[model samples]
Target: MAGFWLGPRAAMRGYRLFGYDSIGSTSSEAMASARRGDAGDVWFAALQQTEGRGRRGRVWESPSGNLAASLLIVHEGDAASVATLGFVAGIALQEALSGNLPASALRIGVDGADGLTGQGHAARLALKWPNDVIADGGKLAGILLEAQGLPDGRMAIVIGFGVNIVAAPTGLPYPATCLHALGTPVSAEAVFAALADAWVDAFELWAGGRGVADVLARWRRHAAGLGSEVAISHDGQVVRGIFETIDEFGRLIVRDGARGTIAITAGDVHFGATATSGRT
Candidate 1:
């Protein structure tokens, strides 16, 4: 199998790729390259990850044939602004998956929390807060961001993406699904090709923080749990409210009626009536 294939946009932008049949971690490779003073704008991809990691250092099961990749870029911005990359990644990834999936399998419903059997479609392709892509309320893909300040005063940001194509891991907090489960046999290469192009457009729209509103508008279009019951777990506190909106800065905004509106910078969000049962 080929190591990597760059999309038209990626090629035009001079982005490089290092594809591996199997590897430890794409994100780890990106970090090592940055430390070696390699310029950014490169992608690290692999067919399998023997020691992959998820958010909060959880074990990311990267079996063979799954899509595990990372991008190393020189992103210069304040800490707050840099954090928005996660949102950008989410929108881009969702777009990529949308392009690769059949329209019939996707429907705008709950994020697939407790199974959307009655409230219309079960769950469509949606973006979860922070950095998760869901289909039918099960986690389809995830994004992880890490930043390192270089000695040259530049910031190297590595954005990692893991998509469940042929298979989805088991025993997760929430449910999990893959392309095959949705009746699609898409390959990792195909997914990466679409993602390479989608990310370019999304990133350009972000415009280094100048076009946040535009970027967020696209995100809201496919966001789940809007106007529904939402429970956010943050910093040892559980906050319940209605899913209001995401602010321009990418904060999850929840309205709790009596407590008014709350802006959440980080937390685990559960929506719909099954929100109360979304415990690990």
Candidate 2:
């Protein structure tokens, strides 16, 4: 795994990586490194996490076989663009896993849509609003973006992701699944390797949000429940409406019966009939 990142392809792009058998959390470690003025393009991976968490401080269960990884970038772009990187990460992750999964395990939509009609290989994977990946109508992966100002007058953006490669957590608020359960049992190491390369490509495509239109279009192509009824919880209130489209700036656009179009920047989204417990 180290050799893959240290090779010319990754080294030329200034990629550095570290791995741990067990750690508190990959995101926490990356944030600490950034505060110490470490150069960016660093990837941290852990076999297990003792203090892992997801959106809104929800517990993130990282067992022995799942993929817990985070990437730190010293960003100098606008805050809006930096926030959009979460979407970029989501797209990269979906593309990476799709390439590695078997063809038989890939399908366009949860309703059995044909593959060729969607976004090529990415068709099988769906990007649930802000930064969640869905497979087989269940949660497959989650992304969390944490940012803080650096002393050098730049922003440190840590993009953390947890993928269910070997197993998924049980007794969650909503349906959870893993690659193994979906007929594509892969190792955490393999997923991390693919993710690193995919991230580089995705970052280049994002071009510091200059190409956000393209990114948003690609994400919408694989978005789940875009035209279906869904609910979003924010600030202790729940807004139930039709899932419209994501705006140009990466906010969730919902069409409410009384309020017309509403853009939600942060919230816990729930689809039809799904139990709403925490943010996905």
Best by TM-score: 1
Model 2 earns a TM-score of 0.89
TM-score of each: 0.92, 0.89
lDDT of 1 by residue, 1-280 (tens): 5557989998898889989989999999999999999999899988899999988898899899999999999876887778888888988998899887775654534443322222455336778887888887778899999999999888999999999999999886667888888888988988998898888999999899888888888887778777778888877888887888899889889888898999998878877755656551
Model 2 spans > 4 angstroms off: 1-9, 105-123, 275-280
Q: In angstroms, how far off is 64's CA in candidate 2? A: 0.5
Among these predictions, the greatest lDDT belongs to 1
For model 2, residues 1-38, the per-residue Cα lDDT tens digits are 32223334555788998988788999999999998889
For model 1, the stretches where C-alpha displacement exceeds 4 angstroms are 106-123, 277-280
Worst 10 residues of 1 by lDDT: 109-118
